[model samples]
Structure formats: structure tokens, C-alpha cells
Target: MVTDKDGYIHLVQYLTEHLGIFENSQQQSVTEDTVMELFEEQLAAQIIMVCGQNPSLTFSQRNLVVREVDSIVYDLEEILARVSGHKATAEQSVFISELSCLIKNLFDQEIARMISL
Candidate 1:
């Protein structure tokens, strides 16, 4: 259901770049939780795009979709944490790529489920 598959790669890149910023900054106002929240919002936006402003959806339907999205985000936190902590060795990079694909699949499945409902 993801119209743009490449967006997953971009999401990973965005996460890494922002993580680097937080790591290098001396005055650290931005916490990892803040970064994760922003990432989660971006992810939720992509997954929820299938709804496309359909005002007919009931509150329960919207809540169900959101809960599924939250589940996907929770499952992805381990990969995100690894990406944040690692120095990016070749093996780790490959692992991260695999994890990225898994993340994409999770999002796709959720989007498909939302569309079907």
C-alpha cells in the first residue's frame, strides 16, 4: 500500500542524520525520545496517507489504524536503537538494511489492513 517504497530508505537516513546531530551537539536540548517521536510521526503520516481525508471514517476506525501504527513503531525501536548506537561496520550496515526492509513490510501490511477496513 506504500506508494513510495523509497521513503523507507529516506526514513532511515533521516533517523541516522538526526541521531548524528544529537550525538555531536554540546548543548543537548533534544533527547533521543524527541527524535524517536518525530520519526514516529513521519512514519504514522506515511501509513495513514491511505485514508486520504475520508471524513466518513468513524472514530473507532481511526483509533484502530492508529493502534496498529503504534504497534509497528514499537516493533521497530530495536532496529532504530541499533542504528543509533553503532559505528556502521559493513556487517552492521547490512543488518540495518535487512531491518529497514522488515520495517517497510510492517508498514505496508498495516497500510493494506487499513485500506481493507
Candidate 2:
């Protein structure tokens, strides 16, 4: 249960981190802000649902989850830095597209893991 919760938390952290990267990379536009806000809300709901189900997890377990989240945050920061630009190169665009797909896969896997738990 603890592991399941940890995975979900980590998944959300990854999503938000990427969203932040996207936010920072994009111009200060209303569309970007709206999309980022929506993404944040979606992640927040997932975190709440996962934690609510496994309320008995230990403090250490929770901390472990947070640590994983932090790690992904750092990773996303790097990925964002690489991809952010008004005119991304072909390689940069491919990297961003691949990263986006991988993040989506991770979210799907985490949701399945939570359900199985």
C-alpha cells in the first residue's frame, strides 16, 4: 500500500514538474496559464485520491514518496531546459515529444498500480 501510494505521488510530481517546465518555456500567454492550471488540478486530485485510500502508511513511507517526487522534479527541470525555445531544433522537438509520451505512460501505469493495490 505504501509503495502504491508512493508511486502515485511520484507520478503526480512528475506531471507537475513537466507542466512547470512547459509553463516556463512558453510565452506569458493566457492559454498557457489556463492549461497549466488545469494540469495542476488534475494532479492534485490524483494525489488526494491515492493518499485517502492508504491512510495508514508510515511517515517514512510518505517521506519516501516525497523523495521520489523531488527526484522527478529535478529531472523535469533538466528536460524543460533542453526543450524550451521559441524555435526548437528537430532534436529538441523530438525529445520533448518523447518525454511527453513517457510521462503519460507513467501516469497510466501509476493509476493501474493504485487500482490494483
Candidate 3:
């Protein structure tokens, strides 16, 4: 089965291309705050899109999804602050992998809940 981590790779690749999350400093002003904001927006948009597909989702369910996404984004802000300006590729990869796992778990739980109802 294709896991959320696999899907996250695709999602990150899309975000990197469209949002320039890893672009050179001269090419874009990629601050941690900006990256977090963009990421939150993208996550919200994706949630909204999924909710749109499942029109039976109640208001509380939608709110829960928003809350969860907000919590993750908040955590991401902290992670970004810690890792920002660090040039070590291995360290970055480790952080990214862990974050992706966290995100995948969140998505899996939320999507499972959504699917059950």
C-alpha cells in the first residue's frame, strides 16, 4: 500500500516547485514564518478540497480537521526555527523525515476518521 510518507514526498515535491521552499537565498526570500504560513495555507486548502468531496462531513468534523492542521503547522514553525539557516544536508534530511512521519500519521488518522463517517 502507498503510505502517507510516500504521498508526503509527492506533496513536498509539489510545494517545493510551486512554493520554492528550498530555493537559493538570492532567488527568493524564504523565511521560516513565510514557509510556515504557506504550508498552513496549503494544508488548509487540501483539507477543504477533501471535505468538499465528502459533502456529508459535519461542521464539527471540518473544525477538527482545521484544528489538527493548525496544531501541526504550529509545531512546524518551531521545527523550522530550530533548523533554519542550518546547511548540514544530513541534519536537514533527518528533520524532514521525522516531520514527514508526523504529518503522515496525522493525515492517516484524519483521513481514516473522515472515511469511516
Candidate 4:
């Protein structure tokens, strides 16, 4: 679970340091829109962190990462589907799509390696 832990730490650090991306212009305000955006950004950060630590991960550990990514994808898809029916913006869709692709690619590569081995 080192990969997962590292991912979480990195995500938390990113969110804390990059408040502008996560918080509203009012500085203390956090609307539903901002919260959703921050969640997506955190997921992306976690995916990147896990991918970067993949080389150190065992097969079982890699599988765990795959499961984690799959869960995130499912959650993201549900949220996106709900939001799309509303008034979701192009930027939000693009960000989610890009992050989803990154997570999928990393998970696929690791899973393929495990199967080949």
C-alpha cells in the first residue's frame, strides 16, 4: 500500500499548496463546483503518483493500484454522467477525460506486465 499512501500524500500536498486551483476567488469559499473540480484534480495527482512509483511495486501491489484506479474511474464516470445532464462546462469534461486516460493507461500497462509475467 506504499504506492497508495504515496499517492494520497502527494495529492494532499498538491491541494494544500495549490489553493488557487482548489479554492474559490473568495479564498474561504468552497462551492459544489469547486469541490468537484478539486476532487478531479486530486484524482489526477494520485494517478500520476501511483504511476511514478510503479517500478517499485510488486505484482500484487500493481494489482491493487489497478483496482484503485478502476474505482476512481467508476466514481468519475458517475459524476461526469450526472454533471453532463446538468450544465457541466467543457473545461471540466476535458480535465476529467485527460485524467481518466492517464489512469487507464498506467493501470493497463501494469496489468499487462503482470499477465505477461
Candidate 5:
């Protein structure tokens, strides 16, 4: 969203100052703070669920998934930060990691198949 100055300005204005989070916002029905809270709650829930289901892959295989997940999470974090106009919290980082691990698990067999080729 922050790909350019105009776009960045628009985003910041909309999310930070214009999203009804501030008194200047004309629409108070939905604030940025409320939306952020909802997202946080959902992210926390996803992380909890995923972390509860630990993968049974080997050390090397699991680590490889983790590494790839990290890369994806980093990009996700960057995009989220831009959209929210805030840095990612530690909890969010954990959520991302757990989500990544779960995704890796889902594709573990496929990855193993490809690796054996």
C-alpha cells in the first residue's frame, strides 16, 4: 500500500487519522482500534490452535518449513504494518510463526514427495 508517496499518504491518512480512530473522523461506527482488536483476537486464536497441533516431521524437514515460513511471515508482517500503520507485536510474531508451522504441516507430504524427486 505504501508503494509510493501518494499511496502511502492516503493509507496513513485513512488508517491513522481518518479511520474514525481520531475525533476528526466523521464515521464513528467502526474505528481502526476496533478493527485492530478484532484482528488481534483472531490471530491469537489461530496461533493457539496451530501451536497445539505440532508437526511430526523430522528435524531437518521441520526446520526447512520453519525457514520458509519465516520468509512468508516477514512479508506478511511488512504488509500488515503498512496497512495498520503500526509495528507488529511479539504476540503477532508468534502467531505468524505458528501459522507458518501449521501451513508447513499441511504441505509436508507434498514437500517430501518433491524432495524425493
Candidate 6:
């Protein structure tokens, strides 16, 4: 289920949702740390590393992407805290603000059609 992972970040599509429901029931399911490690190894660095590389979202994939991004936005603060040792700083504050803006624009406000990867 989704590359042998236990948890699932919600996607608008049925594939991700069903995988989550099923894999989560397995005794050998993956853990949160595994997902985090995978993200850190793959997509985590890309968030800032990519920077403003927005492109048009395809109609078929938009919903799935939206759900995944929405989950990221929801959990970003906890992720940041883990990375920053829970120490608040002006830079961190500003970054959080920007992340909030991105979440709002992408999901809540629904402004941007393009997502940078």
C-alpha cells in the first residue's frame, strides 16, 4: 500500500484512502518515523530547495495533490518544531507565516493553480 507504508496522507483519490485504511490494519505496518524519514530523504528538502517553481496543476492530479499538501500544511508546525528544537526565532516565525500563507492560498483561499515541487 503506497510503497509499503503504514500511514497515508489523505488524497482526493480512492487509491491513497484505501491503502491507508488497509495498511493501517496490518501488524507490520510502517511507523510515523518511517514516513518522516522518507519525506526528509525526498520531498522535505524540496519545499525550500525548489522555490517559486510553480507550474499549472493537471486536472486529474489536482485533488490528490491538494489533499497531500493540505495534510502537510496541517502538520508543518510540528515538523518545524522537530527540526528547530522547539526554539522560536524571528526567521522561524517568518517562515511559519509564509507556510501559512501557502496553505491558505492553496487550499483555503484556492488562489494558486500552480505548485512548486
Candidate with maximal lDDT: 3
TM-scores, one per candidate: 0.40, 0.40, 0.49, 0.37, 0.34, 0.28
lDDT of each: 0.50, 0.46, 0.52, 0.50, 0.42, 0.36
- For every model shown, the clashing-pair count is 0, 0, 0, 0, 0, 0
What tens-digit string does per-residue lDDT give for candidate 1 at 23-48? 44344333343434555655555545
**lDDT (C-alpha) at residue 101 in model 6:** 44
What 10-residue stretch in candidate 1 is worst by lDDT? 85-94
Candidate 4's C-alpha runs over 4 A off are: 1-66, 70-87
lDDT for each residue of candidate 3 in 26-89, tens digit (9 for 90 to 100): 4434233444444554556656666676677678877766676666566556546643443424
* The candidate that achieves the highest TM-score relative to the unseen native structure: 3
Could you tell me how far off, in angstroms, the CA of residue 42 lies in candidate 1 after the best superposition?
1.5
CA shift at 15, candidate 1, in angstroms?
Answer: 13
Distance from true position, residue 68, model 2, in Å?
0.7
Total backbone clashes of model 5?
Answer: 0
Worst 10 residues of 3 by lDDT: 86-95
| Cα lDDT of model 5 by residue, 37-86, tens digit | 44445444543443344445456755654454445344444544444433
* lDDT string, candidate 2, 43-106, tens digits: 3454555556567655775565555445644554454444333344333333354544454445
Using lDDT as the measure, name the better of candidate 1 and candidate 6. 1
